[model samples]
Target: MDTDRLPGCYRHPDRDTGITCTRCERPICPECMISASVGFQCPECVRAGSGTGHHPTANAPRTIAGGVVAADPHLVTKILIGINVLMFFVALSDPVLARELALYGLYRDYFGGTLHGVSTGEYYRLLTSAFLHTEWWHIAGNMLALWVIGGPLEAALGRVRYLAVFLLSGLGGSALVYLLTEPNVATLGASGAVFGLLGATVVLAKRLRYEMRPVITMVVLMLVLTFVPLGGSLSVSWQAHVGGLITGALVGLGMLMPAAGRNRALVQWGTCGVAFLLAAMVIALRTAELT
Candidate 1:
């Protein structure tokens, strides 16, 4: 605090100065001072200041984007919901479009012979069906579940892996329906992906050492409601739900496994990739059998 004992400039010894950095209280010369609303800070202190003044979330992982420190708010989930909502309107406006988009089971071959009840011509329907909803309530219910689970899972798994989980889960659901159900039964909705997220949450919660009783309870209730025949007009495709849950649980095991010396993120991606490829291969084989 005494000027007499004040040291010379940090960068130069000849020039003496009394100015000090407000943050670290280090002596700084005029040339080294960076003026601010509160006071002047040294070049070093200014460089390290929390740019926003307010601190970020405690213990939250930090990501840098556009030269700014920010927390990933899981925008992927919202984007997915937006896509589904948009598709819902499109499907609602044209009811015939929904049938074309739906994953119709492969019940018979082109020649009307037994073909494991799976369709062959419209293989793309497997993935497209997951995005289509029958009506307002259909999209609303799926989006509600997605809103609840998607953000947190995306935050935990990151955008790419989160997308893998949803998409692969949806494919798993459709693949199961195509292989197991009759061609007459048509299925569509994001329920399979929502169930997949639910299943992944169970695995993730267990790994994080958190209380999973609430999550498990919700799982049971959802599964029960899924199979319990909500109304005569609607048929619940339990096969797809089960398939998606199983796929999600498997993917979560790889994604949340204990880390070793290897680059674990890469390993997680590999795991998801292999699962996706396997789903695709299976769908291809199922469709191929018809021809």
Candidate 2:
């Protein structure tokens, strides 16, 4: 056999060729080839797969429920943080804009009083209020907590569930504020939801057998600070914090429930449904009273 006439392996300089890895074009030995329905692929080539070309095995990308494609697990947290940062800039754009957008009940009397019961098409404010903050420090503190607590919680519970916790907690906070305070009052900030995350930490800590002391202490401190009335601003909504904490605690408990303990999915969903219904009821009642 003339060595010069032998086909060289595509990936290896010294090796003479067998058949190519139809997909990657790398040379494959007989022993390396794995048999499939259509053809054979080398172990290395199969492991280092390609999108197009001769595929030994046809495998489609897998999808989960809700048509969600798998992606980097951290993507949700990153996107949330980015949105918060963007909203912060938007809130800081003009003094008037900030007052109007930032959640404040009666503290900013003009903005709050004028907008209250006026149907200014600001219904989305309940949701947006979670993203807006009074100052850089407020945003920074919440973001830091989100990064620290959210990263681990999301990793443990998964993105969908983590998002549920955040959104529901925010809604719970808003609902509490709506129920307890005057409509003329406005409240803003992620603190309520962040506090809910703290509540989650407490539950998770218990589940994982981690010390609950730190979480409890932190929660206590947060509650204390919330009531301290920073800079004589009675604008802060303690009711929101309380509601968020309750919601987060319940959600965390649901997450911590054992898989073997009877249809955890149904239980979680039911809990969420109840919370949503309660929030809706509060909103309806308040709107009715206002009207």
Candidate 3:
């Protein structure tokens, strides 16, 4: 067998390298071989394999139970944004209809009132209200915020944890609104959840010891925008925004808590339990005062 006939490394053409990349099976020279944590791979192979690669193979394709592949391929944030957009269109088509189905129920139908049936309860509103926005602008604003903050946070925290933060924050926001506002007023929007995402970003930045200037600036600007009177139109729910912000900060703190020497699951569960208890208390107190 003529060794000279063997394929040479892509980087070192002079060397007759016989070893092929585990992924692409392309011959590579010692100079071109990059040692990964798992195995030896060529620069081209690694570059085209994963993590800034032209063709990533190391990243697994996400699949649901029963082997059903996801369509969007992102996760909770995209799904949430999609739902909000769809609801926005629905609301735009018929404001009255959208309100009757989702927004109006946030107060009269979900809270304590004549329309509060078995299906319509305060417990459900905590989750449902987050999906129900009043108008196109309402959903668009929230979705824009979600797109800005939700993707990075979700990617950092993972899907399940990200979902927990979003849902809990939304619930916490709604609970606060229900506690503070009059029962006659109908409240609906994803602003609470979006605020929660903002809070999470702040916490994450702090934990990572990254620069906090940008995050602080955004938070301050958001607060100013919410409170400052614009054209004498005070239709925004500052309470919900505040509530979501608080919930997100708390959740982010929970995530940052030291899990090194302690049981991670226990700490997470305990934190979540406390958050839910607090939300429940707020809801209960508000319901009592309203009725």
Candidate 4:
């Protein structure tokens, strides 16, 4: 080991580390380093001789949050952005699509037709609305935020967990909007999910022991923007933003917290389950009220 200049982790090339695997002598990051009798060993070395009576297989890399490292770490983020953009274009082609998808408790369309809503068993709108954007600037802003925040988040949490947080956050936001907003008022945008990512970013920064000022500042600024009325007619749903932020923070805590080896996945998904349960409860209560 060079005392002057430490090498980067072999598993995570960008992470500089002073620790080396006792077995392979490869530099390992804190996440990849497993404590051994003599010193720290890489995951491969630990698994090879675990006495499972199985042959040693190749080491599959993992992210900081115990997620399988994919060849393209940002795949999920890209897919989400793509879906939002695609939906935007599709909505532009057919205005009816927006009316059908946007979240609302109940409403009447311009043609005097009664538009079915969440209260009328049109529950799919909760999710569809998150991807629906009527304005180019709205989609652009949300997608840009998604790319900036989501790429790193996806890399850290991996595909499955990252996707879970994004979706649950969106649902949480919808749940809040349904509970608080006027029944006939329509609301739609990706801001809920984007705000959720911002919340997760705060957790990530905290977990990694990074400076909190910038992350906190960003969150406050976004929240402020959410409340500030844009020309009175264009009002951002602060309820959705607040709901998503809180949900993301809770879910991020579950996903990022250190847990016992066998129970890590259990703990992570359990948090997601709890979040979904709360959102479901909110929806149920609101639906009961509307009906």
Candidate 4 at residue 245, lDDT?
Answer: 94
Candidates 2 and 4: which is better by TM-score?
4
Off by over 4 Å in 3: 1-73, 93-97, 100-122, 229-234, 260-262
Model 4 stretches with alpha carbons more than 4 Å out: 1-58, 110-115, 230-233
Candidate 1 backbone collisions, by pair: 105-183, 106-117, 106-118, 106-119, 107-117
List the candidate numbers ranked by TM-score, top first.
4, 1, 3, 2
Q: Rank the candidates by lDDT, best first.
A: 4, 1, 3, 2
Instruction: Return the TM-score for each candidate structure.
Output: 0.70, 0.67, 0.68, 0.81
- The 10-residue segment of model 3 with minimum total lDDT is 60-69
Residues 1-291, model 3: lDDT tens digits: 874465776766765545566677777543344444343465555545566643443433311100112333247788998898787677668876555644232344344655641124546756776887755566767888998789767654556667777888898888887777755566788888889989988986675444578789999999888886544222678878999999988876775443322365466556767888898888777665655
Model 3, residue 49: what's the lDDT? 55
Task: Candidate 1: list runs displaced more than 4 Å.
Answer: 1-72, 106-118
Q: Encode model 4's per-residue lDDT on 141-256: one tens digit a residue.
A: 89999999998888778899999999999999999999999989988998998898889879877875555787899998998888777653346889889999999999999988
Q: On residues 81-190, what C-alpha lDDT tens digit does candidate 2 reach at each position?
A: 88889888887776567666654333424544544322333556666788887677678878998887786566556567778888888887877776677766657888
Identify the superior model by TM-score, candidate 1 or candidate 3: 1
What TM-score does candidate 4 reach? 0.81
- Model 2: which residue pairs collide? 103-186, 103-187, 104-186, 104-187, 105-185, 105-186, 106-185
